[model samples]
Target chain A: MKYLDEYRDPELARRLLSRIEEIAPGDRVIRLMEICGTHTVAIFRSGLRHLLPSTIRLISGPGCPVCVTANEDIDRAIWLAKQPGVIVTTFGDLVRVPGSTSSLNVERSNGADVRIVYATIDALQIARATPDRQVVFVGIGFETTAPTVAAAVKQAAAEGLVNFSVLPVHKLLPPAMGALLEEGNLQLNGFLCPGHVSTVIGASAYEDVVNRYGISCVVAGFEPLDLLHGIYLLVECVVKGTPQVLNQYRRAVSRDGNAAARRLMDEVFEPADSTWRGLGPIPLSGLRFRNSWRRFDAGERFSMPVIQVREDPACRCGDVLRGLMEPPQCTLFRKVCNPQNPKGPCMVSGEGTCGAYYRYHTESL
Target chain B: MKQRTVQLDQGSGGRATHELVKGLFVEAFRNEFLLEMNDSALVQLNGGRIAMSTDSYVVDPVIFPGGNIGSLAVHGTVNDLAMRGARPLYLTAGFILEEGLSLETLEQVVRAMGEAARESGVLIVAGDTKVVPRGKADKLFINTAGVGVVPPGIHVAGQNARPGDAVLINGTIGDHGMAVLCKREGLAFENEIRSDSAPLHDLVRQMLEVCPRIHVLRDPTRGGVATTLNEIAQQSSVGIRLLEEALPIGEDVAGACELLGLDPLYVANEGKLLACVPADEAEELLQVMRRHPLGAKSRRIGEVTVEEPGRVFLKTRIGGHRLVDMLRGEQLPRIC
Candidate 1:
């Protein structure tokens, strides 16, 4: 905890706030977007929004990995769990994610073989443990998680485990950002890019977004100051009418993030038309295992039927994710859906905006 | 006469469990004081000072390295009192036992509680117990309430934190959390990540003996340092800045957290306490803390400030600052 505590120095943080107040003088409405779940949680958890001047608004973005996972994809994973001799391995967050009619938890209650695994290696180990069963890892999340699953798929391929495969609903984040900017629902002035994702895709991946949108993007660590500094930098950019992607989390994120991991991801996955929860299907926004690894693809191995599902009658997760609505704004937020009995994907995951708001901000509301 | 009995879930309420207090607790711990046996206890003290605290213990795998839920109940309650600069004096233990829990295990936990109370120089003179059917309780659950008397004229509370006060920690954070996590997750490792579940009131006592005007005191439990600091910040209406390097995280824990994608700052700890002291007194307090076994690795980690009220900022070793948010949702259920 040595080098870690200084960044939390309240005095320094205060000084930075003053500096920001001075730099961004007058009533200028500066809207900066932080596109990471960690950032969003930090903002709410620490009451960071109150620290900003009235003119500055921190807008939430589609940064949560769980929030973006399409319902159909969740249903597809649930479908695999129902099949005989099929074992579904996934992250803890995915278990509670609502599908069309049910979730993996519901499936588990109904006697399905669904297990939560911390790493892809765990699934590989599971496949090794139960040779008679087909272990399918529901690969979700963005680039930070994809490489590990890609590695697992490669392992399954090399081992020639006929029973092991990955249902890769893996997403690429940059493309989605572009799609969001094009839609122009909110005039996003700047971006507070995710540090962990940056650790995979590097700071440069955001360069085009800066150039195209003429907005500043700061790759920030999940730390409060890193975020505030990123916002400060963004404010500076808007004031100067100059847009660029700046790397503030230098220790972990670089211009080129973990190149070796990125290479592994590229080697395994090819662009595919993947569906997003709120955004629908964006072209080449998702990944599929390469043709060479087709044999190791769980989507191909399992006969999953195409299905359309309706959102819960009252949930406003789509609007919540789009920053169009807050948790209290949702009719079912604390009523029909809660931490104990989540009705939608937004209420399930810990990183879900609605879930965070429900647990912490409900008292204030 | 009260006899050994089973424990029931709190959800079952006052009935079904047949838990009726006989006023033994009120008699043993009080000296011509505390007359009634109402739903809550009321005590009046001489004009010195007072501190009151409540805590619950529901540790699964029930027992582990260093301690069990019994000693933990004592430690947790005592520590809460300690945070307010109060030397703990009395404690009450409440139990909710699953129907099938063994008498042997129950005795062992009680013995632990007794030993911890004895060591911390506190007494558990009050008690309650209830029994629930199978699946209603997780082996055993304990809730403890404690009261302590502060010295003549010392003011200590969450709201006392002032800007520029230094933040100090007693030893490392997250051992208890990682210990529970590894065991709960069935993660085997070469090194034993045991829980740091020991009574911290003694450490609190030592700290106060060395310096009385400690602005703020808290043991970062449950959601870890992140949540605790946020609470303190809101209460104090101030900001807390932490030096990433100043944090005392164990190497194995760092490795384990990184591997598991868990944040150590947000991980729970049972034995550690965070203190916000005068900037000048932080180093001296750390020196005093180092002399005690509980705070052998105690160091100054951060400082309180007035800049951004109710925020916890983490400055990394490499000079980049990030906001350390309190865990919004439960990280791992039943970690305690």
Candidate 2:
């Protein structure tokens, strides 16, 4: 707790809070979007909203990879899970997300071989152990995780693990930000960029967003002080009319990011047009297997009939992801949709906007 | 549609576990004792009050850093009875061993259990064992039931908590949980986390000696301090406010929880207990608890309040407040 406790100093946090209050413009409503799922959870967990001034509103973005993953992708993963002798392994967040007709959790309960793994290497180890059966790792995350998966794929190829494959649903963060800006649905003064993702992709990645939309982007860590300081920097930018990409989490992130990780990702994958759950068909936002690593692609290795996917029309997860509406505004927020029995991805994923709200903000309700 | 079968979440000791207990088990065996729903059941026997509790240990790795399933079995049941302000006297253990289990391993586990029972001043009066096929059961599983004598004129229950009462914890939280998780997942940190799995009957006895009017004594095991506090709040029809800065947590445990994207409040602890006592006697009780080794690091973490009945809130370090709700399903690691 050496490094962590220092950031959570009560005296320091008090000073930062007062500073933010003093500079925040009181005449107009300022909307700041935190573009990382982890930040959303941290903000709620720290009760920062209650402490912040009334004029500044924090909106959740489409940074939760599980929430942004389209239903068709989940259907395809469930279809792969149902195939005989195929073992499906994925992160725990994706297991509870609902698909068109079924979810991985329900499928697992009904006798499907779905396992929750913390990392892709665990899935690879399973494949090496059970060589007779197929082990398909459902890879889903942002740049913070894609490089690790890419390393796992390279390791599998080197070891010639024929049973190992990956259903790569990995997404890029910067392009998704562009797509959100293009939609022009919500007016956002600035953006709180993801910290871990910035460590891999760097602070320079948001330069395009700033150049295009004139929105300030502050890369921040997940600690309470980091978030408060990040918001202060964004508020400062808004007050000064300076739209620049700032790095408040410089302790972990760098300007150019991790070069070796970017190289590994470039070697294993290529950017492709992919469909997001709410923001559909963002160009070059999804990662696919490069020509050399095509054999590890589960989509190419397995042949299955296309399954039609459907979404509950009543679930307003789309608007929640786009920052167009708050989670409590949704009709099904705490009614039929809840953590125990989630009606949408936003309610299922722990980092989802609605899920975070239900966990932290329900006291007021 | 496929038929619903028992899933892992039902055994997670969270909301799902509560549902299964209330919707099925408790409903089938409805009675005054079951209705109480405290950690242990208090029954009258020969004009004396007795506390009885039972628990099963199915930990994946039969052995862990601080204790094994055998010792854990004893401590778990003994602590359950202690929560009722009873002096644990006798225990019964049942084991289901896998066919492939080695004789040496079984002896080691049994020896540990004997030592733990002796240390806690309890007797393993009865035990039974059976073997199953390798695929049918894990390496080992243990079920322990205990009966203890409740001292006369001592009444402590969850619902007895009153507003303006002070809440105290015995020691650090999340040690047992993170220890088992790190061992099971092979997550090696710079320093290894050891489980705080120990019997708390002695501490409970000393506490009751001084503060006989102690309102509530409950172990924060599965679903952790947050969930246990929520249950107490609902039962007592009061609000509990925890100070984020005052809650004791080990550095190693905090680091592990941060890495896994888990809250320490919701993590499990075996040797930790939450006590609610009158505000006036809290300082004296704290001094007595600190004299015991098990409660050396004990601190007053929160206080009972009249507002927001059936709710538990944590006052953040930055002058903000958030509700600490009960644990839902299992705390899964984040995708980041």
Candidate 3:
């Protein structure tokens, strides 16, 4: 409450709004991308988008882990859930994500033993309780969540729990940013980086993007005021022609991040070229269990019949993820790819760009 | 060691059944009406109209931080009767237990129910128990039916809301739902959040005494304040406009909602109530309500309007407006 209450103060928010309004209208349109799913929701929930100047456009990036998860990985997880004696556990968002043919939620209704877990440690508890059965955890998230999965694997290895394993689709942040920079279709003025992920990877992680790509980057918290302040800072950077990496959420994030979490991640997992749904395979963006920890890898433990499946061909989630198109711009956004019957992963999760846009901007679409 | 779980034979109307009905039920609820042990509770009333309501509670993880399913069942039924401007008097409980449930858990639930009934100044008159084999039922399910007497010259209904009515709530939103969710999901925060699961009948009585012209009295339970407001709006055929800044939500609850991607407006509450009254009488009623224990944090949240008949709107904190629609289903936590 201490940190949260102050950040949400209405009075402070009003002052910041006035400041943002004053800093804007230099007659130059600015395109800023908020590359975090949390920011996307905050922008909508607080009605920050309406408060900002129309000239300043905020784009949703490929930040939602579920939205960016490759189709083959989701299909594999579904197949694992349907296997005999295998109990698949995952976060709640992944339940509704459409795979090649069926989703995990459909598999669950079809009598597969699939459970939603809030954390990976719960999967270990299930495996420990049911010694005769196999517990496979679907590990997904960015650097913010990868450490916890790493810790769970290390704990499993130490306890020698042969029945517990992870089908980790964890991704890194910086490499994906690099890939987005490489695709130079949209003209972007700056970036509002992720807050929680920054606490783990640190503000220094964005230095490479700022220095090499010459883009202004600011790590922001997920409050209305935090977002307003972040946008104001980005606008100022653009107006001043100063491209630098800044830390706006200094209360939680530091320059170096959590050193111990980084150590744990480095010990249990190694970098690998993994396929992102929209971004293709970004080099060293995904985390894979090291050879010593291969026994705890669900993909290695169970033999999955290779299911070559593609996402809905009509879904422009790839374009949406790259900020090339808004969700409503897609032909299937409201008609075919709704939250109830999501045709793609972007519309399945709440943090997904399309889902957030559909929910918060109900009047527009 | 003795068998820790309840057996199917326990509900067979045999010796085990008698022990449970007497040793657990009778001992916990030591009242003369329950001691009668009849098929129906013979409650003597002074010839007046009585309000009766029934509810069933099947909350997962039956035992939570603030209360269990037993207390929740009693509170839910009592609140339902109270919404009709009635004074709750008696309650009946029927429990369906899973065979593998531990006797200790049953005792704990019964004790919590007894405590809640006593606190609400009501008596448990009659009860029933049944058990099924393993996998047939969850740990426990409770059903409660209540009877209360409506005070003379008092009327409250959802359709009573007029254009100039004021919408008021007892306290903060999303505490009960988020508390249960945190406990269920094994989420540990800096401060341990307990459910605000308290009875509001006494508060309602004080409010009615001050302003007998109260139009509507409903608890924001399952579908939360937003759904309840929408229901009231449609029933009354009047629009309701709520100020986003006027809503009372705790800092932790707000933080948790932000983390889980849930709207506090749609999250459930167990102990809070929404009352609509004429604009002039709202201040006097709120004063009386605040004097009561349960209504200290009560505030006027919105006002009924005639503009967009049968609709609800929220003025955002940043001066934007958005329509509030009925929640179609549960607000599941985001997967990421």
Candidate 4:
């Protein structure tokens, strides 16, 4: 509560809001896109958009890992989970994600040895403790989490974890971001870069987007004021005709990111073409185990690639992730895909854009 | 709602889960105030005005260390109404029942709700029950709406925390969230973790008597104190700063949060109130709160500032400053 209560000073927020108003006094319709699932959830749940000036529109992008995760990958994870003598280790969230007709949760109920873990280090520990078990780590998430999983895999190899393997579903943030721009699915002016992901990928990752797409990018922490400041910086950049990556979260994120972590990631994995949920396969958007770590790679060791399947016909998660339509516009939003009975990834993942809209958004015209 | 094979998460639409809400929950404590059969409560203000509030509870496992959803529903509803400077009065309940629930489990929940109401001196005057068919609803979902009469002299709102105002929270945070996680995850501890779920109306009433102009009274529930303070800052359009070392967190909860890669400040709490008041009234209010069981660990954590308004900043234990943002998405889904 020490470093926390002060930033929430209502008077400070007013002053900041006033400053923001003065900085962007012109009646300009600014559309700022936050390219992080975390920021989208933060902005929506806190009703930050409701409090913001109507002129500023917050558009969600391909931020959610699960949202962008391809259908084939989920089917594959499900397939691997059901494999005999294989103990699938995954985050609790993946268990409920719908994969074709069955999910890991269903597989578990029907007798799959799937264990939920908070970290890959735990998975390595499980592998170390259970020599007879083939503990496959269901690797997911973007840069922020990839390095840790990389470190875990490196440690596994260094420790000679013969029975350990990783189902590498790890993704790269920038490529997915570029895919968003390439598709022309979103109209955006500037971007609020992700903080945690930036910690691994570095602030420079957004430079490509800023240079190619002419969008101002500023890495931001998840705090309300931090977001406001990031927005203010982006608006300032747009106003001044400047386009570059700025680090608003200097404490955690650096220009070069964690060097040791990056080294581990490089040693363990390489870029490869990967499929996203809404967007089709983007070249080099995913990470896979290097040849040296092939034995620890679930894809090669388990003799399976991600199952290719069509996206659910009823789910409009694709449009939602692309920022083409609001979640309320979706046919299954509250009717068939309510949180209590989720029918899609958007309704399932806590960080999904649709879930964010449903929980915090009020359908006010 | 239709009857179906009772399976975990199944016919909440009308199987075992439905019978629990209608037969056990509705049967035991059904009342007129909740039977309006409207989308929401329609209360006619008798005096100058009435204070109304909405609270949705999704705390998972539906039960925890010292309490379950039953007591949580009672305390959470009463506390929300009390924060508006109202005499905690009546509440209406809506439940999302899951499938395959047991009869004995439903009885325990209803009985707890009754006990909580009797202790808080409030009634479950009106209510509606729905079945989601099993596997659809998580055990049960309770949404409560309450109406209270604000006293003539008492005035409280988040927008009133001015510069030179003092900020305080009841006891520690992360306790309720951690306790629930401990029980649900089957994590064993040296001592049993317990939920601090108790109605704050009595404690709030005593505090009002001492400090009638208490600017804000809020239970830091789902988003914990970090989220609650963020709400207050934005509402009051004021800046807030707090000392980190002064904030309270139970040792076990802190440990669990660290282990789970979660910040305790961002976790949920079933029963915790954050009171923001002017500096001059801080001492007396603290004394009054201390006299009550709920506020024993209550202490002044921060102050309101005119500069940098609408931000919650904290001086860390490491002698650093950072922004404390409101929790964005569900840290843990189905958690109240």
Candidate 5:
């Protein structure tokens, strides 16, 4: 709690809140988007939104990897789970996410040998232990998680674990940000970049967004103080009409990010056009195994049948992820969808915008 | 499509489990005793009031850091009886063993159970054992049922909680949960986390002596402090507001929860108990609880409120507040 407790000090938070209120312009409404699922949850968990000035509107973007993952990819993963002698391993976040037809949780209950692992290394270890069975790891996340998966893949290749393979659905943060700006309908004043992802890709990663869209970007940590400070920085940028990339989480994020992690990612994967659940297909927004490591790719290793993907028409998860609609605005928000019986990934994943809103903002609604 | 079957989430002691219980078990077994829905059922037997409770232990890796499944089974049942201000007296245990389990492991488990029962001043009055094929059951499973005598003038139930009642918890949360998780997953940290799997009968006894007017006494076990508090809130039709800074959590457990993307409030605790007492008597009860070995780290976590009836809120470390909803399913780790 050494590093964390200090950041959560009420005294410090009050000072920062006061400072933000003083600088925030009262003439017009200022809209800011937090493009990270973790940030969205953190904001809600701390009830920070209620404390912020009403004029500054914070919107949740498609930062949750689980929420943005396309139904086709989930269907593909479900197909792999059903394969004979295959053990499908995935992060816990993806197990409850519904695919086109079924979910991993349902498959598991039907005895499909599905396992939830905390890290990719655990999947590798499972593959190493069970030589007779094939282990398909469903790799999902942004840059913050891709390095660890890449490291595991490299370790698997070095150990020559032929039974181990990955369903690479890893996404890049900056490309999605670019896509969001290109769509040009969010009408955002500033952006609160993810801290962990920024640690891997750095504050410099958002320079392109700021340069291209002339939007203010502030790299932020997940703590209350970090978020408030990040908001104050963005507010300053908005007041001065100067769009720039700033780093408020200097302790964790650097300008250039972690070079070693980037090197590892480049060695194992290359940017490929991938489909996002809400944003549709974006060029170079996802990572795929390089030719050298292609053998470890589950998509290449297994003979997968073509999957017909479908989305629930009633679930406005696409609009929710795009920051076009709030969770309660969806017709199925708490009526047809909830944490107990989620109709979309936004309600399934903990960090999903809808899930966070439902968990923290239910009373207000 | 496959026929609907029981998934692991149904046993997670969260929303799914609640639904399954209400939709099936409670509907079929509708009775006044079952309707009360306290941890243990209070029954009048032989012109005397007694607490009756039953629990089953199927924890994976039967042997864990602080205790084994055998000890856990004993503690679980004994604590349930103690929750009703009952002096746990007798217990019954049933064991389902897998065919290839070593006799040494079985003996160790049984011995641990015996020791725990003895420590809690309870006798293993009756028991049975059965064995299944290697894959039919896990290494071992234990089911325990217990009965205890409730003293006169002692009235404690979840529904007894009222507005202006103070909520207090003994020691830290998330120890047992994190310990089991780390041991099972082979996750190592700088400091090893050991499970807080101990009987709370002695502590509860001490607490009642100081304030027999204790409103509610329930162990924050499976779905943890959060879920247990939610149950109390709904049962009593009052709101509970927890102080984020007041909730005591072990450093190692906190670190592990942070690493695993788990909330300590929702994590399980084997030996912890939540007591709701009249606001004025709270400090006296806390003083008594702190004298007991198990309650040395006790703190006043929250207070029952009239606002937002049947809801629980947390006053965050910052000057913000958020609703602490019941666990939806199992607490799943987040993707970074």
Candidate 6:
């Protein structure tokens, strides 16, 4: 708890809060978006949202993997889980996410072999253990998790894991971020970049974003003080009309990021146009297996009949993901779409905007 | 298209557990003897008040750092009876053994159970055993039933917590759960985390002697302190506000939880108890609790509130507040 406890120090937090207050826009409304599911969770978990001045509004972006995962991919994963002699593995968050027809959890209860794994390597291990069954790992998340999945694919290829394959739904942060700025739906002052993702892609990854959009971008740690300090840096930048990518989480993040991780990711995967649930299709935002690694790609390895993907008619998860609409503004938020029976991806994951709002927001919906 | 079936969350002893208990079990087993649901059944036998409780242990890797399933079984039942303000007197153990289990392991488990019972001054009055086919059962499973005598003028229940009452914990949170998880999953750390599993009847006895007016006594077992507090909140129809800085959590346990993306508040604890007492008597109760070995690290964590009835909140390390809802499902190690 050495490194963690210091970041959570209440004294430092108060100091940072006061600093942020000084730089905050007094009479004008400022909107800052945190483009990471982790940041959304940390903000809510520490009740940091409540401490901020009312002039600054924080919005959750399309950062949650489960939230942004396209419906077709989810439906495909469910289909794979149902196929005979196939074992579907995914993170716990994705298990509860509703697909076009059924969730992985529902399939599991009806006797599908769907396992929840903490790491991509666990799926590889299961493949190694079971030679007769095809093990499909549902790869999700941003740069922070992409490298690990890439490493697993490389390991599987090296080990000649015939039973192992990955259904790659991995996404990049920069492209979606560019899309968000171009949409002009939500007027944003700055951004708090994801800490763990920044550690992989590096703080410099956002430099292009800053240069193009002329917005304050600060990479922040997930702790409350780290976030508050990051907000202070952003507010200071906005007040001074200076847009620069600053790394507030100096301990873990760097300019170049983990170079070896990038190399590994580059070797196993390639950027391709893929669909997002709310954002639709964004060019070069999705990751796919390299041609050499296609044998280990679940999408290529399986030749199954296509199922027509259907989106919920009333769910406004698209606008919510873009920070254009609050979760409560959506008619299905707490009425039809809830954590127990999520009609949309935003209500599925705990870090999703709707789920966080449903949980931490004390006011009645 | 149809209603979802009962899942594992229903068995986690949180809100879902309450649902399963009230929505199904209580309705099916509707009787005066089973309605109290105060850890143990408070019944009158031959004009004397007695408490009875039973629990089964299916912890994976039946053996752990501090103790094994054997000791846990004994400690769990004894503590349950004690929670009802009873002096634990006797216990009965039943064992289901997998055919392939080694006698050496079984001997070790039985020895630990015997030692725990002896230390707690609870006699194992009767026992039963059965051997199952290899695949039908785990290596070993233990079920223990206990009976204790309740003294006059002692009535403790979860529904007894009141607004303005103090909430105190026995010791550090999540130790037993972490110990078992580490051992089961083969996780290693610089400092080895051990289970805090122990008989708490003696500690409860010491507390009752000093303050018999204790409102609620609950072992924050399966769903940890958050779920336990939420249950107390709902049952008592009061609010509880916990101070994050005041909660006693072990350094190693906190580190492990951080690494695993788990919240210590939601992690399970086997030997810890939450005591709700009058605000004025809280200071005196702490002194008595601190003297007991199991309660040496005891501290006041929170106070019952009337602001938000049937809710729990944590005054976070920062000057912010968040709701501590009931455990919904298996607390999956989060990525965020």
**Fnat of every candidate, listed in order:** 0.00, 0.62, 0.21, 0.00, 0.73, 0.57
lDDT tens digits, residue span B1-336, model 3? 123456433442323444567888889989875664421232336866677777777777788778888888888888877887888899999989999899999999999999999999899999999999999988888889998888877877777789989999988998888888888898877787667788778888888888898998888776578877877887688989898989999888888887786788877778899999999998888888888788889999999998888778877776656667655434632100
* Residue range with the least summed lDDT across 10 consecutive positions in model 2 chain A: A356-365
TM-score of 2: 0.95
lDDT score, candidate 5, position A357 = 83
Q: Tell me the DockQ of each model, to 2 decimals.
A: 0.08, 0.55, 0.15, 0.06, 0.55, 0.50
lDDT, residue B209, candidate 5? 86
Q: Count the backbone clashes (under 3 Å) in each candidate.
A: 42, 0, 1, 57, 0, 0
**Candidates' lDDT values, in order?**
0.79, 0.91, 0.84, 0.77, 0.91, 0.88
Considering only the true interface residues, what is the Cα RMSD of candidate 6 after superposition? 2.6
| Candidate 1 chain B, poorest ten consecutive residues by summed lDDT | B9-18
**What shift in Å separates residue B140 of candidate 3 from its native position after superposition?**
4.3
User: Candidate 2: lDDT over CA atoms?
Assistant: 0.91
In model 6, what is the error at residue A63, expressed in angstroms? 0.8
Per residue, candidate 5 scores C-alpha lDDT tens digits across A1-365 of: 88888888899999999998998778899999999998999998988988888889999999999999999999999999989999999998798888888999889888899998988999999999999999999999999889999999889888988899999999998888889888989889999999999999989999998999999999999989999999999999999999999999999899999999999999999999999989999999999988988888898789677888888788889999999999988888889788877899999998999999888886552
Model 2, range B274-315, lDDT digits (tens) per residue?
999999999999999999999999999999999999989988
CAPRI-style quality class for the chain A–B interface of candidate 3? incorrect
Of the native A-B interface contacts, what share survives in model 4? 0.00
User: Chain A TM-scores, one per candidate?
Assistant: 0.97, 0.98, 0.96, 0.96, 0.97, 0.96
TM-score of chain A for candidate 5? 0.97
How well does candidate 1 reproduce the true complex, by DockQ? Answer: 0.08
What ranking of all candidate models by DockQ puts the best one first? Answer: 2, 5, 6, 3, 1, 4
In model 2, which regions exceed 4 Å deviation? A160-162, A303-306, A363-365, B1-3, B185-192, B332-336
- Per-residue lDDT tens digits for candidate 3, residues A1-365, read 56666777778888888887788876878999999998997787777777677789999999999999999999999889888999999998898888888888878767899998988899889999999999999999999999999999888888988899999899998999889989898788899999999999999999999999999999999987789889989999988889998899998999999999999999999999999998999999999999988888888788667788867789889899999999988899878677656888888887899888766675531
The residue-level lDDT of candidate 1 at B209 comes to: 81
Interface RMSD of each: 10.6, 2.1, 8.6, 11.1, 2.3, 2.6
